[model samples]
Target: MKKQNIVIGVAPTKRSFLSMEEAKRQKEKFMAVIRGIHPDVVTLVDIDDICENGILFETEKITQVVEKFRRAKIDALFTPHCDFGEEQCAAGVAAAMKVPTLVWGARDERPNTDESRGRDTQCGMFACTKVMRRFGVQYSYIWNCETESEDFRNGFDSFIRVVSVIKAVKNLRIAKFGARPEPFMSVTANEGDLATKLGVTVVPISPNTVAARMDQLIGENSPRLQDYVADVKQRMDASGMKEEAVERAAAAKLAIQDLMEEKHCAAGAMECWSAVTVLGAPVCMALGELSDEGLPVSCETDVNGAVTMAMLQAVTLGKEACFLADLTIRHPQNDNAELLWHCGPFPYSLKDSSSVARLVQGQERFELKKGPITVCRFDDVDGKYYLFGGEGKGVDGPETNGTYVWFETNNWKMWEEKLMFGPYIHHVGGIYGNYKKVLREAARYLGMIFDDADEQGVYSL
Candidate 1:
């Protein structure tokens, strides 16, 4: 499936009693400041055509504004107060849309010596927020700052990422290939709760179907299989791998992609205990390539792990690939460092520049490049789902084996306690960015408890 895009309805608001010239000027400047955002990232649909001065002020124009935004298929509504805004009108539009809503006001100009202000954007924002509450419209807020200010830019980026995260989970579709191994009880989750509570759909893949597809490509020597093997050779050091094994891994990747497309799945969870029978190879490299290509697949049939990957990918706007890793062991030397490793399933694109990308025995091997990263786990107790999010940097450490990294969290002991006491497992979905705030807001909208490992101390089960 193609990555989703966010459409924001930019509806500037003002009060009739406010200085019209000043409000108009503020609206113009606000547009100029934010227009730098690319259309691909967030398509801006302004209300300039629906009302005079491109400013919203009159309650009578609410219907037209909402209709226009609906036509544009806006994923969120942004109502900026040009001056003390038309609170009632803005609230009406937000309540009608019923999507994620946000409101902000430019910092008001300094008041005159006699207490006369050029415009009271913040004062208006306060009034508008009260009306918004009365209307029962939930929304996000940006602190009162100039639209061009760095603080506002950070808030705006965060808001868009939050919207993307919500989009990722709403009606999410995950593919299930084979059953979870008996030993992997930690990855088990309730499909009934996922469907009934979260609106996520689980599509099961028949083992026979997977076997037939892989056999067709390898046994028949399909030309498509050769193309994929060539891609494998170009991307990594496949010379040490068996020729037939490399071909089998390539076949598995193509077969999985075909099935995901036909099944309309955004991600996948596949059994790995009997890798030889299920995928004809180790299957680690196959999973890695799929994630690099934008479809993350979790090993050991960890469906929630796949969900976690999709969530992290959404926050990055699909610009970075996600890795599902084992939260294996603490550093032998560094007090705060821990090893994040998997047999061979990390995306080659995430390899450190200093490390060599290699494929041997159908597994990937390389150290992931160091950077700011976020690791999160999705799980539940009973029917109450939650997202455990924590941020850290990939640090230097001894590398023993597999695709791996040494992560130095803010507090390793604290993080360990949270997992030990919570409904979490060793498998975590991670990506190369600090997205804890984005994940927190997303969990808020999803109605899931967000366990912030950095902020919250260990709690009793």
Candidate 2:
């Protein structure tokens, strides 16, 4: 999530019969809007150098626009209807780009006072949608609206997130540090399907490898290791813990991270009990630290859970980190509340300010701060892969053990039924904002079914 590394291809489309000057002016406004909307978060490469007046219309110029975007290595394509667009040309460019795509146009002005025609941006956008389907081009859309309206901005932001998910999964590489714990059959995954369908790979790393690395990292006591130990000390009250325990935890963190980095992995899953056995301490604190730094790791070697965490992290464009938690229990007093807890593996940055952070048996113990949260999972059943997402909010409940929070969904019964009746499990990836809709949109591009817990209208092409 370099944020700025996600490049987008801009296609300003219009009808050649319309005023060329008007299309040019509109293209300028659209370009400015794209640049300003999410400044520094995304890079934009447009067709201005190839298309006449920087507007897409003539069929002959489609190849040039496609080649330019291809050469730029764009992650997504955005088509703005400058006027009644050349629908076929827009479709051609998107089909050629073969990336997550977005289409939209500014609301049209009323016809001239003299009864002359004005730019029918909405009409062109409507035509483009049909051709996009005709050309097998999948895309998201912002409805006919003013370019500066909040609606347009929200849609564009959502589209960018969709692009983020698509780009991330295309190059996703998760490190499977050890086999799944024997008891957790629910966390099993189809690695072959993950590779064939989503282009995701799981790099295997045996526990023996991690143990060797941990031993070497511990013996070093290098400046970097000492700095990490000091950093952890500042994050929590380590007064009751042994200095050796903290140092061991810090080394373990560095060890797993170094291994993942060596293998070029963005996510990881580990057999936690084995890790504890090898390091003489739980790696909960280390796991939390890694997730906080944007490298999500799930305990019990939950590969699918790690994948969910990675997707949820990317959905925020790396601006926010994600957490993987167990949907363990129901609040005794609150019917809709469910406890999301792990054995002190949550990031300290998400710790509740009102609560004191402490280390308990090498586990970081603190309650997570309250906020809107989106609980998501990527799972499969009988070869059918799907993404499950639901929105909730952190709420106060009876204090619990380890690092935890209570998430209250709109409908507790509905959520329970969805998870209970299907190919889902207790492990879920939680991120701080509501990106359920964006997850649904991203699923369309990834060839996964989108399952919404709360009943909502489907917005798909």
Candidate 3:
């Protein structure tokens, strides 16, 4: 997870009847709020310096402020109107910086009187937006007037999460091993489109290369391989699995880890089923371990799934591990709930408290913990990429086999309809949290279609 550095530009105007003192005071309050939420804020131009009676009225001051933001490596920009804002100044700064930008203003005081109330920040925001458009600058805005209110806070927080996703995807590199399983054609991705539009680079690794790495590790009895084998034994009760299977699984884990480090890759997607037969063991537990360690590995060589997992990891700042599963079955007891299951690749930390995750037949199997979860996918329709998500909760269900979770949504039928008719497949990424809003907002910021579900119904943009 990368820390975001934001630059805040305060806009005010001498033309407004609002006093300079009041404008300066409001600017300080807005700055304080931002500082509380994000400590790394670059306010290069001080309120006092920008405002004699207005903010950044002079071109020379705007240039200086832009230079400061450039030098600071600012990730995003925010301009809050303290009074009737200087629209040109705000637009000028945003155009110069050319980053994700936001514009907002304080609500007007009630009972407007000629002497007591004169700040028309609402009107100023409109003008600011127009100028930004004329300059061909893309930005976001808080529609509400109350900057101190909860609505504004929510918007700001969502913006930060959106920025985090953008930053994570901009320079992302994924290690793709082999091809997607021959039968599962739905998991295919457009590698060229991903690189052209999202700045993602896929490093293709041959199956023979991986096999050679695994053989070398086993033949040399590498220290890291030995340590990983011992650690696996200490962490998992692998008595049910064959001794040879355990060793094979350990070798597969070392091979993947070594390749990831060698390639300087952030995430990976592997042809798990074929690799299982070749290695004489399943790769589920090994992939799960990598996900737990903040390096997400998707099954079936689903490159897009790996990208979605990486986005979720960044959204959570790597504090939580994400699971990749097939929307396998509908719950037997509840029509509104469905089963999210994989062939035993979920992290051990996500296993339900009632059941311990165990290595059986070379795979770890357990029910997921009951809690709020966010289900999402990054998929494309005819090469146009989109993000789809919904919020649900893990519930109790009958355990069949493999890693599973009983996920219940408010409108399960609607969700199912969307999945069937929309540009998505059976595979989805699951993480513990109600991050539907965050994902939706992020999709909007990234200019991708967001298909989201909530209490009201399913909606898409």
Q: What order do you get sorting by TM-score, best first? A: 2, 1, 3
Q: Compose the digit string of candidate 2's lDDT tens values, residues 1-461.
A: 33425888888888888888888888887677778867667888877688787788899998888888888988998888988889888899998988888988988878646756689888778788998898888888888888778898899988988888877787889999778877789889999989998899999998778778877877776888899889889879988889998888888899889998899998999888755776677888888989877788988889889889889888989777788999899988889989999988998878889989998778888999999999999999999988888999999998877999999987787788877775789888899998999999999888898888896433323
* TM-scores for the candidates: 0.96, 0.96, 0.89
Best by lDDT: 1
The alpha-carbon lDDT assigned to residue 439 of candidate 2 equals 94
Question: Which segments of model 2 are wrong by more than 4 Å?
Answer: 1-4, 112-114, 456-461
Q: Which model, 2 or 3, shows the larger TM-score?
A: 2
Query: What's model 1's TM-score?
Result: 0.96
lDDT of 1 by residue, 67-118 (tens): 9999999999999888878888989999999888988988976874675656
Alpha-carbon lDDT of model 3: 0.78
TM-score of candidate 3 versus the correct structure, residues matched by position: 0.89
lDDT of 3 by residue, 367-455 (tens): 88999999999999886888888888999989778899999998888888788777788889999987887787767767688877553
Q: All candidates' lDDT scores?
A: 0.86, 0.85, 0.78
True-vs-predicted CA distance for residue 27, candidate 1, Å: 1.6
